[model samples]
Target: MGKRVLITGSNRGIGKKLVEQFAQNGFNIVACARKKDDSFDDYLKDIVRMYNIDVTTSYFDMEDEQCIKRELKSVINKVKTVDVLINNAGYGQNALFPMISSNELKKEMQINYISPIIISQIVSRVMIRNGGGSIINIASVSGIRNEQGRLAYGSSKAALIFATKTMSLELAPNNVRVNSVSPGFIDTDMWNNRSEQIYKKVLSETPLGRQGNTKDVADLVYYLASDAASYITGQNIVVDGGRMI
Candidate 1:
């Protein structure tokens, strides 16, 4: 009986945490991922058993346009309406521009920027039919500030931020709201995978003196997707633990 939400890349990290938070709030979740395994299966089983919320999993590959189309089709066919859509499937790349390969740059953009666009377009149709919905895009602080080695990732997030703003305007007439959550120095696998030197440097600069946790981002995202944010749209909220300032 809860509102249905379709969250991309929900198998791990911030996306996974978001799934848990939303489920706690009594939301029916369509947790989409690029693949499936025991870990995610167990996670979903536990969430469903514990929260008693309706939960389904879908397979999605952002880089493959065909895969995006197929997954969207399957979701729409399965769920009559998607009350909330979270564009959170993206990748991060850090390296000097000259040192980064063109293919790598393209892959970053495809996952971080293009993939969201495709998913939004497909999902927005379902929202349009549902009369209204909320779109929460997971962006990054790099979207607002330039960093030493985040050339590709930063640029892609910047585009996503812009997309959230513009999509809000276009979807508002149909009663849909679009917004973004930009987190800085989140303590997710993305950060853990970075070199120790880079991580240390980032931590040294953060005013909070620590990295953020996935739950931090998940909480904010869940709030934005709720009825409490009914009047909010076209905004990029920075949840960076004051790292930007």
Candidate 2:
């Protein structure tokens, strides 16, 4: 049996790519998403057929804390051992400070900050029992730098980055590694949803002169979760193509 990895939000975008990458690399995958429809069902089947790796799908909703706890417990029972956990389920809702509603802010915090922390807490226990594991939180470059209309999203991700550092220190003694990946403008559906003007502005600002792809982030994440990064923990590695510079 191969080492097992549990990835949240694995139905699309970076999460989806991570599933494919890890599966292709010989890791048994526990792919979680908020919902599973016919399209995603077919996608999962295709992944299994193409990769020939064990792939399990589960439902996790970051919006509902109780649901998250219940679903995670069920997942733990089924998987038995989760060698790596990728906390990739989050949403980016941009809003200027004055225009940001309390409800939206709370929702973003719940999905981006609170939920991942909770998931880590539960999964870290499993890792501890198994002697060691890796936990990777998918943060964003918006957390590290200031930008217009990003008050809520940026603040929530900033909290997640800080939480990653703190969790690493606390979990290291137990042999579990905790880290975060902060991705900049990745050309996913989320970025495609933005106006073309926004894309031009971001491209001009990016030192690489282009947006990042899902694989760019997934490759880094796969390394972090592998033994190659055995000595690395408690860090936030950015994949923004030097945009922060």
Candidate 3:
């Protein structure tokens, strides 16, 4: 059997691709997402067939604190001693600063930053008991820099980056390594829905001359989860194709 890993928001986008990649590499996957209907059952079944790995699905809504606590407590044993935990459930904030409400900002923080922190606390205890584990936080390039209309989204990821570094220091003594993967504009559903003007602007500034695909992020995540990254922690690796330059 391979190492067990729990990844949130694995129903679609980069998160979904991560699940597939890890499972193919023989890792047991605990893939969580919001409650799904029958329509999505086929998706999970397809992945199960393709990977030949155990993929456990759980209902998690980050906006609800009670849901997070309850879900984590119930599955604590399954995730306890797990090899890795990927925090990947976040959204984009497209509203301008003046138009964005305080409530919206708070919700963004709740989903993008606060929930991941809470989940990590629960999982890290399990890792400690099991001797050690790895944690890979899925952050964004926006976290490291500023954006015009991404006040809430960017700030939430920024908070996550800080939490990742601090937790790495706190968990290092216990042998648990924590790191982050900050991706550039990836080809996901969100990117597909981005306005043409916004997309063009992003592409123009990106040094790679093209946007990234979900596999690009997933591949990097797989590498970080391996033993090759054992000595690396408290670092935010930017997978932006030199976009920041």
Candidate 4:
């Protein structure tokens, strides 16, 4: 049997890519989403048949703390060990700072930052008990950059980035590793919803002059989960096409 990996937001985009990447590489999967998705279910079915690996589906709202714990606990009870956990479910907001409400900020923090930390805590303990594993938090470059119309989303990712560092430090002794992958403009479902003006603006600013795809992020994540990156931890590796530079 291959090592098992648990991933959140596996219904589409980068989450789906991450699931497929690991599946292709022969990993048992615990794929989670906010709700059930038929297309994604079919995709997983194909992966299971192709790889001959175990694949489990978990559903929970990131805002529901108890449900998150309960669902993960059940998966853990069955699999006993998850070699990797990816916190890949998050949303970006485009509201201006002045227009952003406290409720909106709180909501972003809850789902993007706090929930990932909670999930990490639960899974890391399991990793510790199971002889350790790896964790990757899918953050955004907006966390490190002070861009307009991203106050809530940016701040939430910033908190998550910092949490990844702290968690890595504490968990290192237990043979677990934690890192953050900060992606720039990726051509995903989130990108499709944004305005064309924003797209052009980002493209002009990016040194590569093209938007990154989900595979770009997934490839990096796959390496971090492997033994090749065992010496790495607590780093916020950017996939931004030199936008920050």
Compared with the true structure, all predictions reach lDDT values of 0.90, 0.93, 0.87, 0.93
User: After best superposition, candidate 4 residue 217: deviation in angstroms?
Assistant: 0.4
Lowest lDDT 10-residue stretch of candidate 4: 185-194
Better of 3 and 4 by lDDT: 4
* lDDT by residue for model 2 (1-245), tens: 89999999999999999998998999999999998778988888898899888888889689998998999899889889999999999898778888899999999999999999999999999999999999999999889999899888999999999999999999999999999999989978878999999999989999988889999999999999999999999999999999988
- The runs of at least 3 residues in candidate 2 whose Cα sits more than 4 Å from the true structure, single-residue gaps closed, are none
Worst 10 residues of 2 by lDDT: 90-99
CA lDDT of 230 in candidate 3?
86
Candidates ranked, most accurate by TM-score first: 2, 4, 1, 3
Off by over 4 Å in 1: none
Residue 145, model 4: lDDT of 95
TM, every model:
0.96, 0.98, 0.95, 0.98
Query: How far is 189's C-alpha from truth in model 1 (Å)?
Result: 1.2
- Give the per-residue lDDT digits (tens) of candidate 3, residues 1-245: 76888999888899889988898898988878888756556776787798787767778899998998898888775645578999999877689988999998999999999999999998888889888999999999889888888899999999999999999999999999999999988898877798999899889989888999999999989888889888989999998778888
- Give one digit per residue, the lDDT tens place, for model 4 in 1-245: 78999999998999999988999999999999999888888999999998888999999999899999999999889888999999999976789988999989988999999999999989999999989899999999989999889999999999999999999999999999999999988989787788899899889999988899999999999999999999999999999888999
Ranking by lDDT: 4, 2, 1, 3
> Candidate 1 or 3, higher TM-score?
1
C-alpha root-mean-square deviation, each candidate: 1.3, 0.8, 1.4, 0.9
Clashes of each: 0, 0, 0, 0
* Positional deviation of residue 158's Cα in model 1 after best superposition, in angstroms: 0.5
